[model samples]
Target: MDRTILKSQLERYRTPYEEESAFIDSFIDLTSDPLAYKRERLEGHFTASAWIVNRRRTHTLLTLHRKLGRWLQLGGHADGDENLIEVAMKEAKEESGLTSLDLVDSTIFDLDKHIIPERPHVPEHYHFDVRYILEADINEPLHISDESISLAWITFDSVVDMIGYNPSILRMLEKTSKSEILL
Candidate 1:
């Protein structure tokens, strides 16, 4: 698909919480099919991101993925439902416990392809579509879950300074800082 068409198609789900039942279909279309990526839809590994920005500051939050050992925005695979926005919303709520966020109609980033290092049951070469949703109303205190070793909402510049951030994470920060996608 042309980049413009692909982005326009993705922008259709501005309010995922509204038309939620069709999320899976959109996921297949947006991703060119779900299973072609990482884990199952229910497991949500096609790389749709759900994010919450500090309503007052616009700074985005991130989780320190325990297993992945990278500072990343909150997101996962489609799980069973493929609504990309729902995937983003669900992942954001589940990862950060902030229920008041609103999903931006546009993406903050579209890193549609990348590989994961090998893990226990999962294989390497796990490709991801990686869409980013900007958030509003991010003042809620976070309640950490097993997916993260720790979590913090920081300025993109600050996150770039972390010691463990890999090249990909830093690249993401750079893109976000440049406002290449959303804000």
Candidate 2:
């Protein structure tokens, strides 16, 4: 994602503890695996998420996630906040550092509720994610962030060609793109 814009935007904040906590809590809860712990129902501690789709050049802006290692859209937990559309905007700004953006006229692509698998080291965590899909236009350039190792503007159709080391994010991208959930 981007950096210069985020750095400028975050310069006024003294500490990011509160924001980080909310985001991390939501993320851990969503990606944790509940079934492995014999829990049939997720606590639903973190059910909210928002992702932005950027139409860039002949393709859409996608992130090559650092941890998840896949070419995917920009998204993160809601931090328990219901203003998911704003959350999508915030994540798009912070992660990609792009300032020229607006939520698509129609939230053109939503997806099925899905479970985020827990990592091997943290199997008890699980997230029942209610994902919202949004789109944006990149009027300027893109900035990258540590959260992702790389970034690209990829076509909606070329996603399947880029294999993901971790299939979870890949599945998410596929499902979100294939479904007609946006309204």
Candidate 3:
């Protein structure tokens, strides 16, 4: 998979949180591996997500993940695709049925490494997730894909109450709140 674009983006990303310095560094290093973006790598693989917000930036979309049974941002495995921005856009459209999505920024918005529990055939592995901020018209109708049980636009203030203190979610929210575009 081509990684130059991903490497360039990662190199340009600067985390706001001091504690995330290591995570960013580690993610950059992961890009060095030729197979790092492949799902078959096992150790971990790249996944892209959309932190989809409404035109007003007041509400962010969340999907009730079918497999994980949790309300989380819309995303999926790279499946050998190297361009994560494209992956994120495709996933957002596929998962949410919103075709008018617009990328708020092309750079990485957040990076997270989380473990995927072992399934019957798929062994436990880590997902090195890359998140991007995207905007869409909230008035557009939403069609739930098979990947999600339901999809909803959750207000920023109510996300924590719904997800219960997930650090990644909080960090994304904090970033969004502080973003100049929202000012």
Candidate 4:
């Protein structure tokens, strides 16, 4: 969970998206602050999420985020855990109610920096999200958590149409596609 280790991982990651590559650089710069993982730090905080695909790799699990009301991947604040892979798995299991999940790859599948609108007592800030891929049986029952309004498994072809696609998500999808071929 060391920032140095995370920084090394980010530095080694190669992506076609220049913005994401820049984000990695920015994230590396922020690692100098030891408190980067704290939600209250305000400058920005590390968030982790799962790009969960089914065993068949035909569909991905998405949640209708309760607060944002948007179809998005399952994840949340790092909450002091610097091991982003663990954070992603923990959030995915908690939000999706899936007991069995296997990491598709130990390396990061995607990275995104997005503005989180101010809510209640919290001011506006950025979320430097590190995304990992996980796989589960498509037939597994999903018990939606209070964090989400609903959960659905969206096919790869329909993702963009369903969620008004974000480029980051598309990048993750493309990365997963390539990984699938390698596997």
Please report the candidate that would top lDDT against the real structure.
3
lDDT of 1 at 31: 55
After superposing candidate 1 on the true structure, give the runs of residues whose Cα lies further than 4 Å from its correct spot.
1-34, 37-45, 106-108, 163-183
Tens digit of per-residue lDDT, candidate 2, span 1-183: 122222232233232223222333343333333321123444433333345555532345778778776666676665544444565667777778777665553231333233455766544444434345555665567789888887776665676676434344454465455545432
Q: What is candidate 4's CA lDDT for residue 50? A: 97
Clashing residue pairs found in predicted model 3: none
lDDT of each: 0.60, 0.50, 0.89, 0.88
Q: Summarize candidate 1's per-residue lDDT along 1-183 as a digit string, tens digits.
A: 233444466555332222232343444354555353446432334657754566554476888898878777788775545455666777888888887787665443444445678677765754455465566565667889899998888776576576364555555555455553353
Candidate 3 accuracy as lDDT:
0.89
- Candidate 3 stretches with Cα past 4 Å from truth are none
Give the alpha carbon lDDT tens digit for every residue of 1-183 in model 3.
Answer: 258888878888888676555677778888998888898898888999999999887999999999999989999988888889999999999999998899988878888888899998889998999999999999999999999999999998899998886788888899999988655
User: How well is each residue in 1-183 modelled by candidate 4, as lDDT tens digits?
Assistant: 677788888879887788788778888877777888889789789999999998888999999999988989999998898889999999999999998789877877888999989999999999999998899888989999999999999999999998896888888777777775426
Residue 128 error, candidate 3, Å: 0.6
Q: lDDT at 29 for candidate 2?
A: 35
Against the hidden reference, what TM-scores do the models get? 0.68, 0.55, 0.95, 0.95
Better of 1 and 2 by lDDT: 1
- CA lDDT of 84 in candidate 3? 91
Error of 3 at 173 (Å): 0.7
